[model samples]
Target: NVYYADFDKILLEVCVGKNRLKTERTDIYTNIRHFGRTTKKGYSFKAVIPVDKINGRDKIYFEYTYGEAKVRTSITFLSFQSRLSNKLPESYWIFGNSILSYDEKKKQMIVEPLTFGSHLKHEIKMMYRVARHGRKRIGKKKTLEMLRLRASIKLNRGFGRKDNDSISGAPKNKKPVWITYDQLFKGGDNGQYFYEYMNKNVSDIETCYIINKDTKEYKELTRKYDRKTVLPFSTYKTRLKCLKSDMLFATRIDIRLYMGFTENDEIYVRDLFKADVVCLQHGLTIQKIAQYQNKFYDNTKHYFCVSPKEVENITKPIYGYTNDMITLTGAPRYDGLVGEPKKQILITPTWRRNVTAGTNEKGKQHEYSVNFKRTTYYQIYNSLINDKRLIAAAKKTGYRIVYLVHPILSPQADDFDKNDFVDIVPGVKANYEKMLKESALMVTDYSGIQFDFAYMRRPLVYFHPAELPPQYAEEDTGFGPICRTNDELIDELIKAMQSDCRLEDSYKDNINNFFPYDDQSACKRVYEAALKITNFS
Candidate 1:
């Protein structure tokens, strides 16, 4: 007998020598019953063969097929117990050279095939389970174990250091310290802008920033402030400051950014840390993200939002946040968006999971598929940028086109063909605020950056080459004209250029309804909300 498992179905084959046998006996027991039809295609089939006909020369194959579209899949077996009427085998077994383990929660045997690299095999298998069953079903213990495993993986990837240090170096009798950062290795987002605002307007609280000392952003920051204000990331001193701080602010709530890189470091920060966490989001909430659910942010004290609609989205049953937990304070980076407009068109598209090869524990894509140039995302943008009509129109209208690749897709920046009419910029080096202020028109596909351009009363064109996830499929994105083809996007670009990128009144009304504040006081509001949350006002 041979067994095989695929993404949608399972197959079992019984053979005698070179001949195959078929039977109508469909009753077979496996641990899959514990899931109770978790998959869409839950039905199974089997064939029975006489045991006397089987021989040692006959071969049986037990295989698991993984699809490129699906990141993870698994097969499991179970040992016989009184709970199952003692009809099954007493010992667990696997036929292939795969990682085998026991799932105590479901009382089943788990097997993970070594089809990919072995850098973080166990951790990757755990991620597959979390994706399949979700965090709530997996319980808190498994989730914490996953975090710890992820932390060790990240340390090997140079995201942090493995150092032991004390908090004795921290300031002893200074004011309450508040640490802020956008990314562990980068800056220039809501976190940086809010930290700047805190330093300029308020003096009661001490502000510090954590950034990678090896980055260009760090060199730029050091020229403005002393070392105490700009602490190096993943170092003992930074960890000390984080431990001594009273409050922590960030655009992302990742534990790796605030805690040391080790197995138990994330558990310590999440369960034992005393500092209050305030999430200054990098972008407005425009889609349903599974990671943003309530259980993932158990330590977050305040969640700053951009509008009432965003607040409503967070308070939904899926997100599980209460009204009191949210604050309707606009993004801090919006306060610094002040500059003259130029006749330039910015085309920025978000990354897709299907096209990316894999991401690190911090949700940063460090690799891209070898066939990335063959993906639809690449073909569409590549064709649009190189279109003869679009290139001629930009040249004739005295307009420049800039393509900004999302940071996660930066490794493939060279995949697209370059021409004189268009300039390609990597997201890591892009001056986001500068581009937002200078660009007169913006073209995007499901990027939250569209709101930033809309805040400037500029025109926007959306390109939809693929269907969005189910959560965002029903979202009403009527703030701009959505284009479905390369020709349609080119036509919209020419039309916007003809009118000097003036936003339509209907879209203007949409933008107005989306954002309640544009008075450059969002940083102040966010600061006040943080002070209130920490009871430091």
Candidate 2:
């Protein structure tokens, strides 16, 4: 059974008996045997039933209690060996409302729920299939075929024919159609900077920037560029443009946002769109991420790197990227991280998994609002921001604290305690480039934004109340001194303020070593690399 963590308790009672013969009754405690949480924000549990006590005549009754509600379910016992014997013909199993489709060659079953919406109750179905003969992973061709079938149905219903025609009605040109986006809803990342560079420097190729229509960045961009060049994300026009694109550039590897596809459709849609993908990268590759490996990004033709160390990290056996795939170009956003900073301390922290329920394919925040404040992430940061010592230190140093909540945690922005000296800013609405340039010092907890701050040679303080290990241990990445407590963070801030928020000499050397290019020419290098990949150079 799968349930939210908010449930008071969950228990399973199994009764096995018939009309004439009575058998043993078992009460299984689900918490003792945990299968961990599912990706959809629900805890899964396995009940251990004694199969030896059951007979063919016995009726298996299963009852589970969640919150104040009690639900009774029944299941038939089927031996694993019997199922693998190939005695049963190819069949579709309907467990509750979900339909499980089994693939014989792949030896896997995909469970799809028949009902939709939050009020629908569903059952958990588990099917284990072991391949008798060695078979490769399921091919993407079948998935793409299904996606195209669905898309054709939608098109027949008059969905996107006009938009498709508008995008494909371009004059003949040798250059490829380039599509770039960053976070979909916002701009000012490497993708946006690269798009702007292409529009300014390279005129022969077609370029389109995808952004959310409701965003302030969209309004700003529409005013600056023609409407045809700036396309709203998840729209019919953007989806058609993605299908027609020859080159795709993004900070995130999830390319479904531009095509208005769900998370489940990412693999299929990536295979559907035949384009050379260039990873602009959201941040420096300091921490190890399994998804960034070569197998996951098979369509990626070029991966932008900031320094040799980052290139080395990606080329490692774990990441599995060849040396030729990496383009040694700094992030394009770094070119705009220039300006005289004011006497303000920026507090930016990354999001925690406990605080958010989950995100949709479009990257919208779905928060667990009811228990958001109860999380350790909220309580620790809320207390730290409102701490009198930190507040007084900022006041004494004549520096204001601007607490920028992560975009994923933006839904719970108001949950934090309000203070006089600190101003809470939602990440979605805030201009990150502006904040990065105007801040004197930054206080963060495992955020890649620290690299942006460090690029300006400014002082930074890492608040690690959880005592998380640094991403890079073998060598310094030129990050600030880590503070394990609120008091320690305040002390570090005070010290930084005393020295006029200047970066340490040792850290300066490390920063120079970390970034291969700091000449504000990252856009140029990235543009050249893109041209080379597309054979435009």
Candidate 3:
């Protein structure tokens, strides 16, 4: 029997001595109740072989008939008697570039990946479409009690188990530290700086970077740091390193890194390894962000706080951080923001949670509504950038509008007008320090980059299209000139640019009270803290 990825048109053909004989459809497979339905989850087709009637010269074929195109591949059938005759190894029956295995617990045949998309490169990546196409919730409905039972069963799987040395092959060192960026992609903020500090500056410690296999940094880091260890994301080896290392550092709270597999996985790892988790925060805290709510777990021992007010107002009270766990190290990303300003006005706005709230026919989640132009937030922000008043103001003032969009809306940036006066900066390609330094004024709304601009003594104009969300409204955003209407935003931009973008007195006060470090020693302090082991348990 063979299993392929999900497709509507699949047939199994049996050939005896080069003569066309019989064809089988997988939908009729009912030896197992879930066989017909498993194809929706990327496992398609099953072939029942009549091996007794076939000779050594006979062949079996699988055909995928899609639209007008037919893709056919054949494999020579060795024999079915290998299991009964005991003359051949388990590798006798291999098909379609995949290993066939049976799941004893599920009572079904299991193909390792169940998909061929994993083998393709980036240019021809079709795995995402195949897995997500025609996806719908399946299986029998269950009551709340049944769901609870399943959860309890999963929680109790490896509870209180003895330490397993499955991942104990990590290098022998006095201090082993693991560092990673958000989602294990690449470093941009404090995570980047600290990873570099330990990877290059510190010689006594062993540094390992956790990276997603698809990330560009994965190959680069692996090639550069040949002497040190580099763990690929979502592997047992990486999980073991997280569990055994003296400390773990990352940009955000990733619960999957600790207890994703089982509830006791975190307990076993934290207790056995005494691994302290440090959060080198991605940005400054101003609003009541959802990601920061009750983020501290048992193993989360230290948080790199940027300011005292952030700890006093947001981090300590709302985010559940104690004074001992808070380390007031100004963000290392800001160390590069100290430079001259160019005649460029940057327009950056926060993302609306509701804009990306619709679903497609296949029940797959997608952001950006078809009626996005109707939303007040979209209309106001979009109109402002393309507004003749703002563009003309920039042209007359001898300034260019360098629009640095949020990474979420980056792909759609070109959807707006592209004039010589307005340049759309790609978020990934742009050098953050140089862009920030070149911009004389920042036009924003509740984005942390506003703070970055204010900290650098550049003028900022807050443009609020409608009544701000209560979570963001409640927080103080310093003393930048705010614009509630389109006209007001335009007036403020022209006024700031005309006056050469001077910093307001109240903004200076906010800056003085916000960041603790002014000597550019943030990286040094964060690197020093990375070496110490804090046992939160």
The pairs that clash in candidate 2 are none
Q: Per-candidate TM vs. native?
A: 0.67, 0.67, 0.61
lDDT of 3 by residue, 1-537 (tens): 345443445443433445444453322211222532333222223345554544433433444455666655533322121111111112211232322322233322333321333222210222222122213211122222223332333233222212321222122234545555543444355665566656777766666766556656667767777424666765665655554465666566554442222321221122123345577767765554533433433335677777786777544343555677777777877767777888889988776665545432111123445565656666666677788988888888899898776655454555566777888875544567788888888888777777667667677888776654432444556757778888998888888878877887888777666666665678777776654533211
Greater-lDDT candidate between 1 and 3: 1
Error of 3 at 405 (Å): 1.7
Ranked candidates, highest TM-score first: 2, 1, 3
Which scores greater on TM-score, model 2 or model 3?
Answer: 2
Residue-level error in angstroms, candidate 1, position 236: 1.4
Q: Write the per-residue lDDT of candidate 1 for residues 335-373, one digit (tens) a residue.
A: 977778899999998887777786544423458669898
What is the alpha-carbon lDDT of model 2 when measured against the actual structure? 0.64
Could you report the Cα RMSD, in angstroms, for every candidate shown? Answer: 16.5, 15.9, 19.4
User: On a 0 to 1 TM-score scale, where does candidate 1 land against the true structure?
Assistant: 0.67
Error in Å for residue 482 of model 1 = 0.7
* lDDT, candidates in the order shown: 0.64, 0.64, 0.54
